[model samples]
Target: MSAPDTNLEKQERRHKPSMIALRLVIAFAVLALVGFVALQMLGSGDPIAEELETGSAPSAAVD
Candidate 1:
């Protein structure tokens, strides 16, 4: 058996606010962009009415 060396050290982790803020901003922007594109694809009409007009049952529940 060998003697253990006494060179142990502890590290303190630090958080960077600027990087976190940038990542959050990017995530929100991407989500908003995807949401906008989805809405555009759905078009500017009553979705259920459109589906009914096309002779298919509305896939979503009506309020």
Candidate 2:
């Protein structure tokens, strides 16, 4: 038996709705991660200065 040659028509590929939604979700997740990192970098203060201002040892108990 011989297989039929069904490659006569070249079909145009279209983006699936689920694929588009997945891409959008991935893009938003990346953006969110970048924003979180940016906020962390921008909001971080000097740890030594904070410790000095607090005037307490790191392991000291506070009453």
Candidate 3:
């Protein structure tokens, strides 16, 4: 019984490192996805479209 328990514990220990690495990878992936979505939401727009709708171009000359 003790021998079997030790074997089980060793297997669990072997799996722990991989599990931690997998969790870290998943966390980074989620973080990257969130950042990408935020950037898209904040930056999504066509300046040309806005200018077309407003029917104006900003003057480059400064008084």
Best by lDDT: 3
The sequence of per-residue lDDT tens digits that candidate 1 reaches over residues 1-63 is 864754334211234566688899999999999999999897768877677778898676789
* Model 3 CA RMSD to the hidden true structure, in angstroms: 6.4
Question: Candidate 3: misplaced stretches above 4 Å?
Answer: 1-6, 49-63
How big is the positional error of residue 11 in model 3, measured in Å on the Cα after superposition? Answer: 1.0
What TM-score do all the candidates reach, one by one?
A: 0.47, 0.49, 0.62
Candidate 2 Cα outliers beyond 4 Å, as residue runs: 1-15, 45-63
- Local distance difference test values of all predictions, in order: 0.75, 0.74, 0.84
- Residue 2's lDDT within candidate 3 is 54
Best by TM-score: 3
lDDT of 3 by residue, 1-63 (tens): 455455877898899999999999999999999999999887558776667778998545568
How many Å off is the CA of 60 in candidate 2? 14
Q: For model 2, how does the per-residue alpha-carbon lDDT over 10-35 read when each residue is reduced to its tens digit?
A: 22124466677899999999999999
Candidate 1 vs candidate 2, TM-score winner: 2
Worst 10 residues of 3 by lDDT: 1-10
> Judged by lDDT against the true structure, how good is candidate 2?
0.74
